[model samples]
Structure formats: structure tokens, C-alpha cells
Target chain A: MDPLFEKGMTELNRPPTDRPFQAFEIVFWHVLDEMFEERLLPGDVLYETALSQELGLSRTPVREALSRLVAEGLLENPAGTRGYRVPDLSADDLQQVFQAREILESSAAALAAEHARKGDIGELEEIHRREILFSSQENRREYCRANVEFHFAVMRIGGNRYLERAFRPVFWRSQLYVNYLAEFHPLNGEELTAESGHNSPAEHAALIRAIARRAPKAAAKAAAEHLRSTTAYRILLDTERARHIFGGSSR
Target chain B: MDPLFEKGMTELNRPPTDRPFQAFEIVFWHVLDEMFEERLLPGDVLYETALSQELGLSRTPVREALSRLVAEGLLENPAGTRGYRVPDLSADDLQQVFQAREILESSAAALAAEHARKGDIGELEEIHRREILFSSQENRREYCRANVEFHFAVMRIGGNRYLERAFRPVFWRSQLYVNYLAEFHPLNGEELTAESGHNSPAEHAALIRAIARRAPKAAAKAAAEHLRSTTAYRILLDTERARHIFGGSSR
Candidate 1:
């Protein structure tokens, strides 16, 4: 294979232009969405040759998109080689990712809940309502988007840029689990009543209440508990599924 | 002038190879350290031409190191940029860095107080002793290093890999504060009459006792209070110093 094909991260040195940046960001965002959607996995290579041809752009823009994707933790270029590939999902990684997410994002949610914007709680309430509706209807795509929106909104309101920056990679890394969440619609608490049952509606409702009440401790606890019950464990269950869907990762 | 000097992130294609990766990493680590030392600053462009000449290698490894540095949050190659440069750090950036450190590392210190390793506590005791000696004699650099070691050891014993990683960059980004702590080092209990006094040796001793006694709450309080005092006026000092050291950023 070509050296660039072998190493995924090194390509970031290429000079970029403004016109290419718009296309690059647009493509990368789309690719990242696909990465989380489970359409892209760890080992499968993103072929610049094919993408440039398909996207009707030069390899420059496509490669630019690839670099940003790599930076975002959606892809990796292993030490010895180049060209980007999906980072393989692993059980340990899943746990670490969630553990970090639990520590950081939970605090973010708590802070957001406490220091939330005037209408933020109302907006989150709407998100919760929409997520539950989408999940009930088994609309995986919409649910995933809403799930991301809800959490991201909370992080923004968390009022701590460092926490947000530090936790970002882990959040992106957990997209594999998000893909799994989409498929199984895991334990949308409307039905069975087990500890693992993640009732999206109820969780969202509680989250809004916690935030509305200006409750950091409650918001933090609720966020951690919600993640612990729903997203965290669900990632564990989907370990093999990730390998099956995205192949294996070298890292 | 070059495209790599632009305002956002974009991917670049890299042809790579299977190499030891050690040389670049060693260099990269030093490069990052120098960045923290303020040897590198925002808008100071990376010269691929010059670095390759000095390293006596092709652009491959040099560019690769630069790419990873960008990923490490020390450098930025904005969209349409052909070069990498250290990111500008504002007071808000510095404050965010410290605030999250206050939350996360304090929690880690508290947690470490619960299940601290025997060797860890012993080592911490020695660290405090050194700080006492250093403060007595005023050994600035050694005291600063000891300060980092003490905090990092506490975080390590916390046994939370996730938290450890999250805490690292924050600590690193605040090295300037560590250096400045030398000037702020309070003499003793008498000097620490106010909240913002450094008396770090005493604080560290208290922290050790808390951890030794497995008092999580006390350990956290000690740790948080120590940093709160040590860095309390750092923001104001930095703002005042900004014009001289960072006139371009003195907005």
C-alpha cells in the first residue's frame, strides 16, 4: 500500500485553501455523521482516490476532510502507516470512553442544569420530547441526532471550555455506541422495568426538571445515572457488534 | 500568506511509512514541552523547511510531529493554512483551564485519599518535605517541579485513568502559574493569614494527612483550597502582564 494509505494522520500537512476548507468541513461533518451511524468502522480505509472522483472534487478537499476527521477522533492513522481508517472499537475503550464521558459530560450536564440559559431548559424539554417520540417510533436516525443535540446543548451550557474540549474526543469515540443505541433503541423505559431500562422520555424529563430547579448536584447525579444505565452499559453489550459492523481496529 | 496559516482545521493527505515512531515522539514531546515553556507562542509559524533541515530528515517526520502537535491542542493549522503555529491563549482560556482543573483534579485528589497506595502516600510525604525545604530556601524551579509531582501523584493514586488524562493538559496549560507560584510562596502559617497565600508546603502536608487518613472530603478541600490560593491572583497578574508579554493579544 502507499505510505499515505498506511498512515492516516500524517496527511494533515498538506496546504489548504479557503474554497477547499468549506468543502472539506462539509465533507468531514458528513463523514463524521456516517462514522457515528456505523457506516464507517475502524479498519476500512477512506479512499481519497475514490472519494475525490465520487465527490467531484480534487483529492485536496477530500484529504482535508480526512485530516479533520482524524483530528476529531473519528479516524486514526496508526504510527507506522498513513491513510485514514476507522478506529477499532474495543471493550476497554468503550468503558474508558464512557468513564471519561461520565466524569466530564455528567459534570457538564450538572453545570448546565445549574447555570443554564433562560430558555435552555425549555429547549431541552422539547429535545427530550422529540427523542422519546422518535425512539418510540423506532426512528433511529432522528433519535441519534436528537440524542447528540441534547447532550451537546448541555455541554455548551456547562460553562467550562476546558471540560468541553477535554471530553470531546471521548464523546466522538463513543459514537460506536450511539450507532448501537440507534439499532436496538436500547431499553426505552416505556416498556419493561429493569435497572438497565433507559427510558429516554423519563430521563429527559428528569434532566429538564433538574436543570430548571437550578440543581447541579441533582443534574450531575441524574446525568451520571442516566449514562450509567443507558449509554454506558449499552456500549458494553455492543462490543462484538462493533467488530462485526466495522471490522477490527489496529489501535 | 501561505494557506496553512488560516483560521480553522482541515485535513491534509500524508503518505506515511512503518518506522519506529520513537524519534518523532521524543522530539514531539520536547516540542510540546517547549510550547508549555512559552518557547513557542501563538502566531509563531512552524517552518517545515527549517525543522527538516535541523532534524536532518525529510519533511515526513517533521510534518508528522507537527500534525500530532496540532492534535495535542498545542498547535493550530487553521482552514486553508499551510503551516502550524501555537494557539493563542487568552485569559478566559487560562481561567477555563484552571476552573475545570479545580473541579476534576480536586475530585481526583479526594478520590485518591480513599484508596491511596502506601508508596504513594510515602512519596507524597517526601514531596511535601522537599517543598518545605525549597520554600525555606526558595528553590523556585525545584519547588515547581515538586508541585507538579505532588499533584500528579495524588491524581495517579486516584486510580482513575480517565481523570488522570483529563487532568494532565489542564495542569500543563497552567505551567506559567506554577512558575509564578515561586513568587507567591507564602512563608508559613502566619503568612497564610489570608485565603490567597501559597504556603503550599503546609497545604501539601495537610493533603498528605488527609489522604493518609483516607479522608476524601478533607483531601479534596485541601487540594482545592491549595490551588485556589496559589492561583487566585494569577488571573489578575496575567492580565496585567498581558500587555508586555502578549501585546498582540491584549484585547
Candidate 2:
């Protein structure tokens, strides 16, 4: 059994106040965690039987989870193949992903500005604080998680369940791009300054301030600018580097 | 077997160049068609065993189709219940749906303005022509179908697969709102005039012209204005009427 799978299973087995987690959901989050943590790199193929055996479960739940991930655009089942692989997104795919993030997240941020309660602002500030802490400590993994949480917190504060739901899969796909960026361009502790242009904490703080001030247009602009800066097209323009980061060749 | 399911099965059995439709997919579309046609009203509960028996298939595919619809927000599985019910959307849900539609469809229209080829415009004009023909003939069903095709065509021309895919389920949920509007407020031939404010044809034409002129912002504004006119909050504000249309009571 894979050590990660065992660790996930132990976590899943812990009792919760709500209903128990389903088998496939456990598998789904486990796989997603692996991808985010870079244990499962782009282009790595996952066989249903191998995963089922590794997790000491039947193939049905594993297959279900794999199909769900594929449906969410996190994984792709190549034509005429049974195995699901982490998608090697092309430059165009990254462009579309970022464009979508800008549209959806900006709208959410604007709505959050309108609807955000004091508690909501507080929650956002807490996440932003963690983001800064993680960045200062150069804890890339935790910083990435906190960054993703900050965006989702904005979406939730928007008070539109439909928009929030639509944002989920797109956000996950963008995380793949984030992971690649972090891998190719590791940020040193000193490079976390706003002048470095990779300073997510400063950008996030601006978004938080806009929402807290109830400035819808400013909030929307800040969100869009943040995404545009983070997903700098110049990085994606290097076909060779993108190919290397996306695993030697585009699928 | 139900005649609708039989008709859908016949269509599924037809020869195609690419591939045969799966059983679950056939069920999915069949159910969606029934909903659009108002043959299956909101608040109706669908039982897997009953649907399988009606379609003369096993429970597996029916279950899969129902679950897919639930995940798509077209149907909801009530807590502690085995059946899936067509959602009886609240006024708030309608508001959120329209807001999302504005955000997504306007983005799509803007992108279409930038990316549309001559052939793409021609295709949209063709669909618009059908819409006008149907509206003039008072063929509400066909007009509705053509209307949906027009929006989807705009999305396709946007050249963003991610946006297009994300638009699907939200688009479907919004269709429920469209159906209810059509049911409650039948349009007379005279009412189809632009002065009557039920003039979808005119609004659609304005959107087409904007896209044809390659004016991205104009295209976006036209699309947003069209949705705003069609989903007038005055209509949704009548909670009692909305409840009656969604089926006697709110879910």
C-alpha cells in the first residue's frame, strides 16, 4: 500500500459530527491532494486496478473517483485508454483557464464587496494573514493552500451558490498552473516583496481591503489584476519551458 | 415503454459517424428534453425503478442519469430520500441564475466578437433566422430551442472550451426559468413587437449585429441587456405566481 493512501485512509476513518465520507469522495480528495502536493506530476497515468489495490479497496470506488476527476478537468482519460492521467495543459489551455478565473473571480469579488459581512471580512483577513505567514516562512505548500483558500473565501462571501459552484472546477484547474509556476520559479523569502511582481500576499491584501471598504469596482479590478499578474503570459509563451513543466510534451 | 423514451431510444439507435450514444446519456438527454418541453414539471419526483421500467432498461443507467442530473443542479436528491425531484427554484435562485448568465453569456459574447470568423457569424445568423421564423409562426417550442442554440453558438464561437463547458449546467438551470416564463406569460403575435417588451427577436438581432460589427464591449452590453429584459424582476417578484408556476408550492 502507498504510504499516502494509508495516511488518507486513517484520516477518513476518523469520526465526524456529520455524515461519514463516502468511499469515492475519500479517493477523490486523496488524489487531488497528491496532485497539489506534486507527488502525482503532470502526465502520470493512474490505472484503476493499481489504485484500488494500493488503497486496499475495490475497483468500483476508484473508477468512480477517477471518472469524477476527469469530469472536473483535473484528469483526462486519453481516447481509447482506460487509465486516467493528470492533464498536461497547453499554453492555450492555461490562457483559457486564467481568463475564466478572471471573469468568475472578479464577479465574485465584486459581489463579495456588496454582501460581505464583518465576519466575512474577518475570515478573509485571517486567511490573508496565514498567506503572509506562509510566504514569509517560505513554506510553499502551505502558502499555496492558503492562497487557494483566500480566493474561495471571496467566492463564498459573494453569496451566490451558483457562481461559487461554477468556480470550483475552474479554480482546481488553475491550481495546476500555480503548482507549475511554483515549481519552475521558486520564490525566495526576500523575493516576496510587492516589487518582485510575484507578491501574492500584497495583491491579496489589496483585494481584502477593497472588499472591506465595500468598493465593488475596486474589488473586481483588484481580483482581475491579481490573476493577470500571477498568470503572466510570458511564462506560458515559452513553449519549451511549458512543455518541460507539463511533462516533456503536451498531451 | 413510455413513448418519449421510445422516441429517444430510436434516435439513439440511429447510425452516426463518430460513436453510439451510451444508455445513460440517452436517458439524460431524454429527461432534459421532457423538462424543457414541460412534460415533466418542476417538483415532480423521479424514481429510478419507475424510470427504468418505463424505459425498458435496468436500474443502473437510470440511476446514473438521475444522479448526473442532480449533480448538474437540474434535479435535487432530497435528504434521506431515494428519489430525485426537478428543482423548484426560489426567487433568489432565479436572481442568482440570471446574474451568472449575465456574467458568463456576456463574456462569451465579447469573446465571440473578437474571435468569430465569417463562417461563425453566418452560422449564428442562420440560427437567428430560425428563431425569428419560429417566433413569427408562434411556434414557442421551436423558438425556445432555437434561442438556446443561439446562446450556445455564441459560446462555441468564443473559442474557450472551459467557459463553454462551465456554461452547460448553469444554462440548463436557466432554461427551467425560461420554460416557466413561457408557461405563465404566453406571447401573442402582436406582443412579439419590440414595443411590447417581449421582443426577444429584436434583442437577439441587436446582439447579432454587435458581434457582426466585431465590437466586443457592445456585444457584451447587448447580451447583458437582452437577459435583463427577458428576466424582468417584476415577474419574479410575484412570489405567489412563481410558486404556482414552479408547481403549487416552493420546494
Candidate 3:
């Protein structure tokens, strides 16, 4: 069993009434956290029995959590496979994921610009503020979390629950690639410099400004350009660097 | 009990080994078919126990089917509510769904233009051919299904499973509206004539031609324009007509 499972066992063993969380929700977040932290790498196979036994829980909730993760595209049960594995996204997969993100998030930004309230703008600003702080302090994990929060906040401001729901899985799948990028090219490293076309913080600021000003076209353009730059950065990494980031898990 | 439940019970009674279908999958399709056929109208609630009893199956599969439908946005388990209800989409909801469809399907068209092989183009042409046939024959349900197949074929040709997955639920939700529109305005009626701007068969042909010629920009523009025209036709349906179509179920 992976050591990461042990890390969350104490919390999982708590009395049911002690917290409002369900067994499957607890397990889901635990595994998701492990993936985001890189403690669970791509190609890591997660067996239901092993996970349930490690957590001292029944196989039911364990299965539910794994199945949900698989449905969300964060994990995959390959054809004829039993256990779920953290997906080893290839370059083509990365391209497709980014392309989907560009479409969804740009439209989300446009909607946010048209529909966002003052309170919504404040919420977005707060998330972006924390994102900048996390970047400045070199907190990679929190930075990733805050970055995700910023995009999700914009989605919420879009005032379309369906759009937000559709964006959720695609956003999380792309985050896996973002997390990998963060691991190889640190937050403040030279690779993310303006010349590398990966200046997300600055790009995020521009997006927020457009939304705050209620400029729908500008917001959409800003969001698309930001994603395009990110895609360009990913492409520039080259196959050799991608191999390093994926840790020999590229399929 | 809904009479539609009785319609599929005969098929559901087959022995487990007779077919490879799961109980939950059968239930899922049965419910989905009812929704698409408009036998299950907006604001109709579906309970697990009731569905299980009607289908002569256990609550487990019934619950699974309903939950999957809820997750897919076909049905909604409203907050503080117990059973799933066919969603009562408002005009804003319709707008949001169309916006999402435009973004996803247009991108899918562009990607298909770039990546589609001859076989994929042939597949799309076949679906469009059926769509026109059904349209001329005044077959609403088959026309709708072929229309869906046409778009899905484009998504498949895009070579991005992720994009197709993201588009599925949104497309289905939009189909509900399309079905409602069809109920109020027949396929060959004046409301869908050239002046009313609801010419799907012609638009589909244009999209296919663009894809066949490998014109990515033209394909994307055709897709976007097609959805925009559909949205326009939806808006043209006054609130009174919408109420009649939804059977006073609009929320």
C-alpha cells in the first residue's frame, strides 16, 4: 500500500457523527490531495480492496470514490482493467485538455463579465490575491489550489450552474498537467518568466480587470490568450522534458 | 405510476444472461428515452421506490439510474428535494446551454476539420443524410436522433474524447428545449421555415462541407452560426408558446 493512504487513515477512522463528511467524500479528497501534491503520481494504480483495507473501511464507499474519480477524468480504468490508475496524459491528451479549457473558460469569462455582481468581483479578487501571495511565498500546492479557485470563482460569476458543472471535470484534468508543470518549473523559476509565455499571475490579473470592467469581449479574449500562452509553454517543454515531468508515465 | 414505465418492463424482464445489459443501464435508458420522447415532461418527479416497483427491479439499480441522470443534468434533484425532476429550464438556462454548445461544438468542428479522415467524413455525411431524410419524412424523433449523431460524429472526428464527454450533457439538455420547440412548431411548419431561421439540415450540410474541405475556420464559423440561428429561433418562441409547450411546467 502507498504511504499516502496511511496519512489520511486517522481522519477516516473518526466517528461518523463527528463530522458532516461522508466516507466516500473523505476518501475522494484524500486521493485527490495526494495526486495534487505529487505523492500519487500518474500511472499509480489504486485498488479498491487495498484502499478499503488501508483505511479500515468497507469496500463500498471506496469503490464509490474511485468510480467518481474515474468518471471525472482524474483517474482512468483502462479497457479490461479492474483498478483505477492516475491517468498518464500524453502530449496529445494535454493538447486536447487545453483546447477544451480554452473554449469553456473563455466563454465562462465572457459570461462572468456580463453577469458578475460586485460581490462576485470581490470574491475573484480575493482568490487572485491569495494566488499571488502563494506564488510570492513559493507555496506550490497552495498556489495551485488558489489558481484553481480563481478560475472556479470566475465560473461561478458566470451565473450558469450548467457551465460551471461542465467546466469542473475538465478544469481538474488540466490541473494535473498544471501541477506537473509546477513541479518541474517552480513558481518563481526562470522557466515561467515573461519570455517563456507562462506568466499566469499577470494574465489572471488582466482577466479580472476585464471582468471587473464588464468588458465581455476583452474578458473572453484575455482568457483565451492566457490559455494559449499556457499551451505554448507546455509545447515548448519538448518530449524529453515532458518525459521528466510525467516521470516515465507518459503513455 | 407513469404509463411510460410499463412500456419498457417487458424488455427489462429478460433473464440476466440473456443480454449483457446491467439493470441500472436498462433503467437509465428507459428513463432517458421517456425524457427525449417527452413522455416525461419538465417538473415531473421520479422516485427510486416508485421506479423500482414499476420496473420490477430493486431500488439499488433504480437509484443508480436516477443518480446518473441527475449527474448528467438530464434530471435535477433540487436542493432540499428527495426525487429527481425533469428540469424546468428558464430562458436564461436556455441561453447558457446554447452558449456552451456554441463553444464546444464549434471547437469540435475546427478540430474535426484538422483531424478527420475520409471515413469520419463519410460517417458525418451519412448522419446528415439521415437527418435530411427524417426531416423530409416529418419524423421528429428520428430527425432529432440523427441531428445528435451528426454533431457527435464531428466530436469523434475531433479526436478528443474529453471534448465529446464534456459536450454530451450540455447537448442533451439543449435537446430537451429542441424537443419542446418541435412540439409547439412542427418540423416542416412555417415557424421553422427560412424566414424563421431554424434551418438545421442546410446548416448541417454546410458544416459537413467545411469539414470535408478541411477548412477549419469555415467549419467553426458554420457551427457557431448554426447554433446562433437555433438560439434565435428559440428566442422567437414567445413565452405563451413556451408555456403551452412545457404544459405550464416552466419555472
TM of each candidate vs. truth? 0.71, 0.86, 0.83
TM-score of 3: 0.83
- Candidate 3, residue B8: lDDT: 34
What tens digits encode model 1's per-residue C-alpha lDDT throughout A1-251? Answer: 12321222122223344453366655665566555545665567777788778767787667766765665566777765666777655566667667678888778877797678888877887888888887777765566567767777788788887787777667666656555444443343444222233375687678778888888888888888777766546646666653443335422
CA shift at B193, candidate 2, in angstroms? 13
What TM-score, to 2 decimals, does candidate 2 have?
0.86
How far residue A9's Cα lies from its native spot in candidate 1, in Å, is: 21
User: Candidate 2, residues B75-130: lDDT per residue as tens digits?
Assistant: 88855577888777567888888889899999999999999999998999898898
Q: Can you write out model 3's per-residue Cα lDDT over B120-203, one digit (the tens) per residue? A: 888988888888887888776566567667777788898887888898888878877766655554343655632223278899
The parts of candidate 2 lying over 4 Å away from their true place are A1-17, A78-80, A184-198, A231-234, A237-251, B1-17, B78-80, B184-198, B231-234, B237-251
Candidate 1 vs candidate 2, DockQ winner: 2
Candidate 1 docking category? acceptable
lDDT of 3 by residue, A1-251 (tens): 23543343222222235335667766787888777657787777899999999888898788777767776778888655688988875676777788788888898899899999989888988888887887788765556566666777788888877778888888777766765665554342554632223267899999999999999999999999888787334543466666545445532
lDDT of 2 at B85: 84
Comparison by DockQ, 2 against 3, better one: 2
lDDT of each residue in A1-251, candidate 2, tens digit only = 23543432123223233665567766887887777666777778899999998878898778677777776778888555678988875678888988998999999999999999999999999988988888888776567667767888899899988888788888778776666555554231333222123388899999999999999999999999888777434456555656555443222
